[model samples]
Structure formats: structure tokens, C-alpha cells
Target: MALAPRHLISLSDLDDGVLDEVLELSARLKRRTGRGELAGKTIGMLFFRGSLRTRASLETAVLQLGGSVVNLTAMSDFWELEEREGSVMDGRAPEHIKDAAAVLSRYVHALAIRPAPLGNSWDVDRRDERIRAWAKYATVPVMNMESSLWHPLQALADVLTLKERLGDPRGKELAITWVHSPTPASPSAVHSLLHAALRFGMRVRLAHPAGFELDGGVLSEAEDLARASGGTLRRELSLEEAVRGARVVYARSWQSLETYGNPTLTASQRSRHIGWRIDEKLLASGQDAYLMHAMPVRRNVEVTDEVLDGPRSLLYEQAANRLPTQMALLVNLLR
Candidate 1:
């Protein structure tokens, strides 16, 4: 009998051994060693929202590895999908997700979906219903580009970038500090990075102002993983305290969980934290830390222009690594 196809919905789906293999393969592929591993494969990428880095990187990775791609944008290239179970089809959505997933499976060797949050409450979004439903119905391997709860592909590229810079990441200090943004952002990137960093035995510090805490369930699981790997996890309200003595200072903005799904409330709370921006002086407090951010960052808001363009900034490298790491993942899943 044939085995079931593998799906990468979250970092937790990969244990230590498989995770390490993926990272190692990513490094090898980065050195131009592995090529054409995805020949004769076709990948279908479905995007429910806009993207720059994620779309470009994945398409480049597939083409470079000798594979073809079919890209579709929801509500533009396809119909509005209904995910609710046992619902009447009298609403705006004309088709259900079950039909979509099943049809896509037959057309492609692997299926990848990127579903943004639907302005819903934390309790509803945290279930990650869209991607989970795809995985359940698709016969081919399913990959998560980014969802309401996790960005496993981004986490993979992050770990690969860290491995390339800092040989062995074990016991190294990594500070994931929250910065200010004019608009509310998703916490999926932060949550995935926390999981990946802790799994590699890196001591992580999460710093954010009051009322801007991350999801409690993600924190608890990350803490447990940290403990098992001899890594430590701590929370700091002050940015200075979190960045101090850290090897890597990663800055990003995320919405407050307390006011999530309420735009007006979330905006009012976020406005008060504008003073939390990262600058050179703040970054200097760390122990020669390298700066990192998943980009499309607002200059002078989230971080200063000097800091983002400085020699110590690894933002570009992080973006560049997305290609090779995704190439590695596609090869692993399809072959």
C-alpha cells in the first residue's frame, strides 16, 4: 500500500530529526549542490491575500528546481470559498472549500495555501480552519504558505538563516521584540519564529508593552519546548531589557490579543506604543546583536533607516534564504 502524503501545517508537525534534515538540505541547496530535484512536478499555489516575498520566492524556487507552477488568487482568479460545515449556499460564497481542495489535488502534485485572518475573534481564527480543511480533503501533500495561526515556511527559512550565520544556534540569545506600527499586524510570524527558535535550543525573550501580549496557548507550548531542549523563555515589558545581551534582535509589530478583531480598540491601544520603535542606540544595548525583520517594514516607524541598511542587518539575507529553504521543502514533500 502507498503511504499517506506529508503536510506541513505547523513547525510542530516536524520532529527534531526531520526538521534538522530540512535545514541541512536547505544549506546544501544554498551552496548550489542540489538541483532539478522537483523535475516533472507541478505545484498549485492559492493565495487568499496579497504577497510579495512569499509569492516570488516560492515561484522562483519551483522554477529553479525544474518544476511548473499554477498560481491562483482568491476572489479574483477563483470563487469565494465557504468553509462552514453543513451550511446553506445562499450567501456570497458560491462554492465550498471541500470541492476546491479535492479538485486542486487532481491538478497538482502538491497544494499550497495562504489564508489570511478573516477579521474574526482569536478563538475562531486560532483554530486555523481554512488550511486544516485543505489538509483534510486534499489527497496530495499540502503546504501552508501562511495562515491565521502559523507560517511554517517562514520559520524554516528563519532557522536556515540563523544556522548559516551562527554555526550552532544552541544556547544563543534571541530577542523577539515588538516594535510600533501604524496598522495592526498578524502574530503568525512571531508565533512561528518562537516555536522554531526554541526548538533549536535558543534562549528567547518576548518583549511587548502591556495589553499587547501574544496568544497564551502558543506561549505555553513554546515554553514547554524550550524546557525540553535546555532553552529558556522569558517575557519582558521593556524593550531595552529584552535586547540587552542578546545575540540576535528581531523586531516586528503584531496586534494586541486583548483587542483582536476589534479594529477601533486595537488601533487605540497600538497608538500608545509608538514610542517602542527600534533605533541604533536601542540596538547597541545588545551584545553585538544582528538585526532581523521579516520585511515590508515601515522606515522611521518600526525601525530607523540607518539600522535597516546597516552592515549588521540580516533582513535581506532572511528574505533571500526563503528561496533555497522552500526549494528544500518542496523537494522533500514531492519526491
Candidate 2:
């Protein structure tokens, strides 16, 4: 494999060998957190929107590796600097992203950013295109915190979790099913999980309502990957049918790509919005299977409090692995 230097902007960016290396290295580094592996190194983190796990986990992970962090609420200072009436972005704004990226590159080992795409709108290609545009001129490698289309870091952590739980995933049945949510900005967890599960050679099933299919290209890519890995990708509208004989049933919500761009009236149609809920019936189908979900989940919507807190739930383990998985990513990209 042609390994390059820096950045983990997408899951597709890393192949199997590179991905495994990062996972192994992360385990080793986490065991030696105080040894100062990156004592003098610093990383810059910027967020254009809100965050919980993505923010806290990366900060903790980098610190454990003996690295320091510089965090910026980008949309705040960056926005003020850009929209100031007469200040001239040339002035106190001090620098544009181009300049900031270049200067920061000289100080920090890498930069991670989260630019949340508009809610209920799933235009990943557009979002990623813009990110790539900025990255083209960046001085250092850029790790995408979460982009319009993909959340590679989350995917990495998830893959590691699967590996730790079920050993090799080569023939394991893994279902990436869409659960219920009030809005479309439910997080790109399922998209990333589908891609990761397929790429890691797991037999994958995608269950979602009729009009709420995943991105066309992402689905196609996953299909190709699944075929190549000796796994299969099957889509089903019935959650029970999808979860049958699965080792893991992962649930998440995403905007219906078919309804993208019409934010005003999409939710007005109540029937469309409720097509993705995870009630008891869905869980009962996979009674013996492990339940997985990326956190910040809605209380009564996507999953009931009972299921989320139940013994079958592995949500906590999934969240905990974010630290080590990220440490692995940082080690490979920076160290």
C-alpha cells in the first residue's frame, strides 16, 4: 500500500494494513500515556458547530500521548473576523484560513476540524468538496472531525470496537440499520458504520425506510467493497428481516438523501419522519445480538431508554474506544 504522510479526512483514505497499524499502535500508546510520546507536539482543533464526543475524546487522547492542544471555536472568531464591518479581514482577523493553516502547520503537528453541515440536508459531496478545497491550500494534513458526507474517525473507532468484541469480522453479519430521530441532522454515524463494516469484510445489512436510503455513491462504493471482501450487502425495509442471524445490530438516523435541499417542508410530512424509529420489535428480532449505537442519541425516539440502558447495549464500550482509536490515528498521522 502507498502510505502517505498526515491527515485522516476519510475512511477511504486508509486501507486495511494502514488501518490495522493505527489500531495496534493506539493500544500500545494508550498503555504508555505518561511516557511523553509526543511531549513537545501540539495539535490544533477547530469546530464550526457543536460537539461532545468528537471534542472531548480527541483532546484527552492527544494529552495522553503527551501532546498539547490548541482549540478554537472557528465559527466564532473566524466568523467575527470575516463579517466585521470595516475591520478588513486583513487587520485584526490577522489571517485567513489559508494563512492560519500555514502558520499553524509550523506550530502544530496536525489540525482537526468539524464543520457541521446544515440540518436535514445531506449534501456530503458538496461538503467534502469544500473541505478538500480548503485542504488543498493547507500547510499540514487535515483530519476531518465530521464532514457532510463521512465521519472517518468515528468509523475507525467503531471498527476497532467490532474487532475487540467479535474477533475477525470476515464473515460476521453486521446490520447498519436506520433508527428513529426527530430531525435529519441525526449524525453521520450510520453512513460511516456502513462503510467501515463493509470495508472490514463483515457481511453487512442496511435497513431503512423506503424514501430514506443512503447516499447513492456511498452505497455503491460499499457494495463494491463488500463484494471484494467476500461479504455481501443486502438492503431491507424490515428491521427484523435485516437483523436476523446478525452478530451486531447497529442503529443510527440520517437525513433522507432523497429529501435533501427542501428543509422547509420535509418534516411537515409526518409519515416520512417516523419511518426510522427503533422500538421493541426491532430489538426483539436480534435478542441475542449486541446492540450498538453512536452516542448523543435521542431518549424516546431512535431507541427507548430501556434498550439504551439494557445489558445488550454496547454503546458505552463504543464511546470508550474513541480515545484509543483516536490515539492510534494521531500516532500514525503525527508521530
Model 1 lDDT tens row, 1-335: 86788999998888888888888888888889446787888999999998999999999999999999999998789988888889998999988888888898889999989986777699889899989988988899999998877989888888988888888999999999999998656888899999999988999999999998988999999989998999989996489999988889989998888988888888888888899988999899888989998877999999999899898899999999999899988887877
Pick by TM-score: which candidate is best?
Answer: 1
lDDT of 2 by residue, 70-101 (tens): 99896565652222224456555554556566
* Model 1 local distance difference test score: 0.89
Q: Estimate the TM-score for candidate 2.
A: 0.88
User: What is the Å distance of residue 93 in model 2 from its true position?
Assistant: 10
**Total backbone clashes of model 1?**
0
Q: After superposition, how far is residue 328 of candidate 2 from its true place, in Å?
A: 1.0
- TM-score against native, each model: 0.98, 0.88
The Cα error of candidate 1 at residue 145, in Å, is 0.8
lDDT of model 2, residue 292: 86
